[model samples]
Target: MAEEEEEKGGSKKKLFMIIGGVVALAAGGFFFMGGGEDEVMAEEMVEPEVVEGEVLDVGTMTIVLADDDPDKLRYVRVGLALVLDITADSSLVAGRVSLVQDAAITVISEMTSGELRGAVGAADARERLSTAAREIYPDGEVIRVVLTEMILQ
Candidate 1:
């Protein structure tokens, strides 16, 4: 009977050791994996810088793309918004909206499907559009061009 009791106590000690080991591992993992700091750091990292501006929506337009293949018809529908400085005159930008639209259409229509395929292409288009608008607008007036919508078909 004493031997059986001793064996039982040994087994109980083994079980307790295993439970303690598991708890220690979990606590170690939590600390090593940045348990609470990860969440706080992520929140801080995800917040974008605040940009103060007057946004002018230039509206959407559909244009036929200049594709090399004559057998297929390709087109791109794009919408643009102009971000102007807070001190910029919006009335001047509004008055010349037609010119901005014309410039956007011309730029997109000249691009082939291969040139407007991915993120790079989209950014290129935006940069070109912004450049074109900047030429028309006065210095320090136009801040940036935002592509609201772009669909190629």
Candidate 2:
């Protein structure tokens, strides 16, 4: 009975040692293989600061869209605002304000009433106008687009 008791205790110690060894190995791998050097030092870790872009209110536009039904032609009047990148040339945008308004009008006129119905649709239209601005003025960078006073009639 004593020998049996000793054998069971020896088996428990062996199991414990195996589990301890596996845990140590896993922790070691996580420390060594991962970017554990600078990551472990909380003081050395730093995140980049995001600077907000400068906003430039270009102007308002009244776009007339021709619907398929002659009686149902629609017009959308919207106010456009552009978020200029930090490195954008303000003079270029200021000098071409009329051109920018024309682009906005062209973009809004191309869209049908169905595409400009809801908030989501308006957001999409804003995105397209931003893209148009970038293309119309390749030298300028438009980071964000906002549409206001959007009236569908």
**What overall lDDT goes with each candidate model?**
0.89, 0.79
Error of 1 at 92 (Å): 2.0
Please give, for residues 1-153, the per-residue lDDT of candidate 1 as tens digits: 999999999999999999999999999999888788889988888955445479999999999999988889899989999999777888987999899999998898999988988999999999999899888896667877889998999
**Against the correct fold, how does model 2 do in TM-score?**
0.61
Candidate with top TM-score is 1
Clashes of each: 0, 0
lDDT of 2: 0.79
Residue 14, candidate 1: how far off, in angstroms? Answer: 95
What would the per-residue lDDT of candidate 2 be over residues 89-116, giving only the tens digit for each residue?
7766677767778888777888888889
Once fitted onto the true fold, the runs of candidate 2 whose alpha carbons sit more than 4 angstroms away are 1-50
Worst 10 residues of 2 by lDDT: 43-52
- TM-score against truth, every candidate: 0.64, 0.61
